[model samples]
Target: MSNLNSLQYFIPELFLIVAILVIIVVDLFLKKNKKIVSAYLAALTLVVTIFLAYQQYGYSPALLFKGMIVLDSFAIFFKIITALSTLIVIFISLPSFRTKAEYYVLLLIVTLGMFLMVEVNNLLMIIISMEMVGLISYVLVGFNKHDLKSSEASLKFMLYGATSTAVMAFGFSYIYGISGHLNLDVIQQSLIINQPQALPLFVAFMMVLAGLGYKIAMVPFHFWVPDVYEGAPTPITAFLSVGPKAAGLALLIRFLITLVAHPSAGNAANFIQNVSIHAPLLLAALAVATMTLGNLSALMQKNIKRMLGYSAIAHVGYMLMALVVFNNQGIIAVMFYIVVYLFMNFGAFCVVESLTDKLGSEKISAYTGLGYRAPFTAIAMAIFMFSLTGLPPFAGFIGKLYLFAAVINQSWYILALIGLLNSVISLYYYATVVKVMFLNRQENAPPLRVALYNKLLIGALLIPTLVLGLYWSPVINFTSRSIGFLFGK
Candidate 1:
């Protein structure tokens, strides 16, 4: 009977699957005008999933399938974020995909993949979930059918994603062979027993990191980011930039804290000693490279979406600093940063979506005189850009502050310094977008009629950016508590 309770733990995911099936049935039966029903069904499913996650909050861990799936605050938090982000994506996509039915279906599948990515404990499950999401995203990116650029982008994304997945699978197979267990906890326990194998273990770990890094678009593995971003639909680009990115980060936390840690007592002793000597140095390099590469490339971008693409890579560098700390505070800081990033980023993408639909303009220069022509969008966008730049009195600044503090607390002063310097460099390009909107002058720009849905969505998110600027304590506390549940350390 207690085992049955474990099934209840997956209520949110079960709800999502049922929602997907219902939407598919409705799509089959509904004709013409009835097609919009799928969007509503998608939205309803997301809302219900969020509600289910909320209900599960503050509960003790509920383990399922001999502990392959654990229902805890950490999973619940990511689940909620994924669901909310998907809901908003659907809303934004409705106008973006007026004629495409497959777009909504693909989105549903991606959401399923993301939900599983955050909750699963087995490495194979993680890879499978990632492939599911990656496949759907590739299709969505090229769904325009007539656009050759879109097709090219989809092909690149698929090839890159497939190669990365294969690399990760090889790494997982090594871990399973070494430890004789697929569960993360079992692997962690095995590492504790065999400390001498650190060299081989680290190699496998790096390979796995390589694959996950590609998903997050970290430096070196980030080659495919800008092209894919530029070629995809504006709304789909926004979704990719936010949804999968966050899910990937979430899984990184789980992997780093659970699977990477040594499990046996004597092995753990040797492992801990070596990690302090080598891990920080390795992460520091990643920090410098990712941020420098992303910022330098973003400076040359003509398309606003592609620029944001490079910017997202740089942003990952900032978040990566927290992970380098590898402690409770670092995890909390990263969680908080991701939460803030979702708002600031999705909000920025919303502005791009609004402008693209309104003016049919995507070039950076197209934003000139928008401050006067579309005051609300311009102001909202300016706020998002400033937030992205880590400026004062914005959520981005607070997120960065906490992340830096986490690094400093761990005595990784060098990484904290590099992260701060990157923020300074990032501000230059992020500010350029603001300058294009308000500082650059143009005459007789046409008026843009902002859709009510877009307005409501942007307006809803702007409050958090402003509020977090002044009162970030609650968010920090919630994130810290959630991280505690995640690591139990």
Candidate 2:
């Protein structure tokens, strides 16, 4: 009965579950008319869930379900981001995926899973939620089954996801066997006590990190990204890049701050600290490699989507550089970067979706002479590309500034310099898309028409890119407070 009483603490998740069931039931009855119902329900559910999350803002943390989950500021922050990002993705998808209603259902489940990913305190719950999210994404990636590209994307994503899951499970088994604890906090405690036996522990943790790195598409584990992104539908690609990436980062954050950074472990603690310092080096190397590789690969791509796919990988490297810092500033910078990334990446995809739907082409040359045909969209794409390349007067520039600043503050000067250089290298490819849009001349390019709903969505995203770029203080402050609140500071 006492454990049951703890239900009060799980209102956000409860609301989400109830909403999912309601949406599912509604879909069962509505048949072809189901998407409208599902969309509204999903959006309303997320809004209510966000409200519930806000209600828990000042509440003390409480463990529930036999200590498998805990509500804290960190979880709440990610929950809110998950909910909001889902809402945005649903809107973004509406114009592109109206023919496929299943996206609504899959997206809701994925969002719920991501929310759970943040709240779980135990490895079992984390694995369950992580897999739940991954499965939904696999479906979403290939939702347009008629498209051979979509099918290929789905297959590649599923194969990679399965392998990563198996690796993670294997690593978890080692962690449990070695530490004799399933709860992350308890496992951290055990690792500290067994610090003298560090080799086995480091190996165990690295395996787990390797699995997570795959999810985030970090170096050595990022090979599948561009193929999957290019092959997936535009809206689904947007969700894949932003939603899962953010969830992966949230899980990574939970693991690092709670599990690996515990102070009681002598050698293990030192190992983590060394990681904090050397992480920049590893990420710096990865950053240089990823950005150069991604850009160089993107340079040869004719498909616009594939170009963005490689660009996303390079962006991952940048985000990882911030992660390499592993401090509060770095964490806040990461969260901030995600917000900007969502707008910039989604905006770019919106343009892609709009253009493809209208022009029936995804080729880079298809954008030739498009500036005169679709002035608003071309201009928007230019802005997004500029932002993506970290140019001034855009949020991407600010995001990169803060990220580099955080890295340098940690005394990772070379990492900072490498990041700066990568940004410059990235500019060329990103500019190539812009050049085609504005400078290239071609024959027989038709006029582009955008839906009213899409125009509104694009305009809505544009406001944030401009606002956050010039006035980032509020976001930085909120994110900093959110980070401090995570560890109960």
Candidate 3:
């Protein structure tokens, strides 16, 4: 689509851009409750943006802005995901970041970056959007300038982000040198027609994967995750855990199917036929290592946020299992799992943030006798823990079931078994959190008071986590539909 035609379909982003500016202007004048008012405005904007995104779902998919981006269901789906996640992040920020208007401003800016992250269709947009998100994230991570850990995490995050993106851009140069194009579709055609040699193309592909993997916190590229999660403000840590990670996965899936893999007849499957890389063999290795290392490391973490950070890495590995097959079913599994994970992971973090606000601690020991002190929140935390462990009658179990089934459908039975065993290993650490909360006794501990929104927010996240487990067909069908345009069906 041309620039003029693209604008109509891009209303959600336009509204967001306008709203961000308005909020900044609004913040400048207010002396009282400035951050609260700005956050409320940001949340309102996201609600409207989510509505605008839904409207685009009915629009026919198009290459917007002269192929710079694609307006499609897949992109729309992620737009809503990132926006909605950030909305929750805004509310959560009221506790730790409500005093500073810059926190809300930076958040809105990073949300814009994430919006562009999913819709990118050109190789250059990848670098542009990613750096936009990365730079803002560094600022947000270090927002608590007084905290040494926060400052340290920000520096490490910046270094890792810069290195991966530079390597990935270098890889993109090699790709353009070979394919002579920057647009994903054009690059795909060029590579298919020219049939580049195996070795160089494979190396270039891995470099790009390293960049995407780092964003999603895939192992080896995941060195920054634990520290970043622990040191950043709880709200920002929660945002980091979900928002950018989902965008990275969106880009990864689109990049793989469009540039490396070919959509099979009738858009029924995706396979790396044109590209010479052994994606399945390599992805399987990463998945195994990511999960094993995450689960093992998580078992030793004393801080709740750091444990969830490693746990986030483990969940990424689980999602990667579906991609080892790289079929339409696998795609649906990944998309569904990401949604399931958003609620479970955020709920766990929410519980931690809420309690930490009152207790001024993030350690597991602080949660002793939580069941007696804060029964409702403790129970909610237990549900999140159980769901995270992929237990029965929760969204996480259903999500994992779909992923395992997808891998099995391709006859990758051994890989599926390994994933199941890893799930068992994860159970120990997740259950340990529950055990500490309810089983360990702490006499005369003070009663913990949770704010009204925190209580309501946990219920909001909890409902979907449990209901989706019982009635997940709607979401399954929705995810199946969302990828239609990705494969041009």
Candidate 4:
């Protein structure tokens, strides 16, 4: 599809752009609760955008913007992920950021960036979309200028993002030079037919991986994650944890599927140009390192936010484990994992965000005796903890089951074993939160009261976290259909 034809499929993104401009103008005139009004408008904008994105789901996948992007069920699936994550984050944000209308506006821009992140089909679009998201994220991380950590985090995040962008662009330049094209499919065909030399292609692949890997918190590229998560406002941390990360993964999967790997028979994937690249084996190692490091580091953290920060990395490792297979099984497992992760992670963060205001601390100790002091929140946190830990009867368990199943089915027993041990190790820290909440006694403690709206928010995220655990066939089926089109091509 050309630019003009792309507009019909591009309504959601365009609407988001128009909404950002309109809300900024609206914020100027409001005297009271400007942020509140802007937040509601932002919420409305996301709701409408989600509906528009859903409308795109039934259409056949088409290359849009003259082959710069593709409109497909795969992209639409991730669009929903980004939008739902953003929509909920807006509600979670309103409580703390009611004074800054611009805060909401910045969030809307990040949402726009995430939207572009999943739809990219050209190598140039990859850099452009990532830079757009990265720049705004740097600003969002430091939105609280009063806090020194926030400022420091913003600086580190910007530096890291800039370095990764340059490396990615450098790698992409090699690719474009060799292929003489910018569109991913065309570049892929060039690679297949011309068979570029091994050394340059290897360097380019790793460089590009480093860039995309940074977004998903892949190890060696993940140094910025903990600091950024801890320093950013809780709501922004929640958004960073899921929204942009999903976009990164979706983009990565598409990049690899389109450029690096090709269909091998009915259900296998392999390097398009060379078998010795061992991409799957390399990713498997990263997955192990990521999960082990994340779980071990999280065990040492006292701050709840920081703990969840490491936990997010571990979850990324789990998703990467599935990516090792790089087939329909792998894609299905990864997609389903992303969906469950969104709910469980948001619910956990929602509890932290709701409680940190009253407790004055995000430490695990702060939650001691919370089982009695704030039973609702404590119980909710415990459920999220169990889900995050991948316990049975929880969505996280189902997510992990699919992940491990995919690897085991491929006879990667050793990788699956390491993943299992990591899951067991994670139970300790996650259960630590549960233990502190239910068992530790706090004498003369006051009863905690969470705001009605925040409670509503928790419930909104909670239902899916629980429902998906016991009954998730519909979700799996949906993921299968979404990937069917992409893999079919």
- Please report the candidate that would top lDDT against the real structure: 4
Q: State residue 72's C-alpha deviation in candidate 4, in Å.
A: 0.6
**Range of the 10 consecutive residues with the lowest summed lDDT in candidate 3:** 263-272
Error of 1 at 431 (Å): 1.3
| Tens digits of per-residue lDDT for model 1, 1-489 | 155667777787788788777778778888767687778777787888899888988888766767777677888788878877888888878876654555777787898899888887888789889999998999998998799989999999999999999999998888887788888877766765665366666777888889999999998899999999989887788888888988999898778765544322121122355332355566668877998899889988888999999999999988887877676777778889888888898899988887785667789888888888878988999999999989989999999988899889768887788788888888888888889888997876667778888888888878888888889898888776675555453
Q: Comparing 2 and 3 by lDDT, which wins?
A: 3
User: For this target, which candidate reaches the highest TM-score against the unseen true structure?
Assistant: 4
Identify the runs in model 4 with alpha carbons over 4 angstroms from their true place: 263-269, 273-276
Deviating ranges (above 4 Å) for candidate 2: 31-35, 263-288, 443-446, 485-488
TM-score, prediction 3: 0.97
Model 2, 1-489: lDDT tens per residue? 146877888888788888888878777777674457667777788788889898887666667777788777767878888788888888877765554555687788898899888778798887899899988888888888898988998999999988988888887887788778888777766756664255555666667777787888777778888889888878878877888788888888777655456432222223354222233354557666766677677777888888888888788888878877676777888899988998999899888887786777888887887788888888988999999999989999999988998888878787778788878888888888889888986677667777878788888988898888999998887688776545446
lDDT of 3 at 324: 85
Better of 1 and 2 by TM-score: 1
lDDT score of residue 128 within candidate 4 = 88
Residue 9 shift from truth in candidate 2, angstroms: 1.8
lDDT of 4: 0.89
Work out the TM-score per prediction.
Answer: 0.95, 0.93, 0.97, 0.98
True-structure RMSD for candidate 2? 2.7
Q: Which lDDT values do the candidates have, in the order given?
A: 0.81, 0.78, 0.88, 0.89
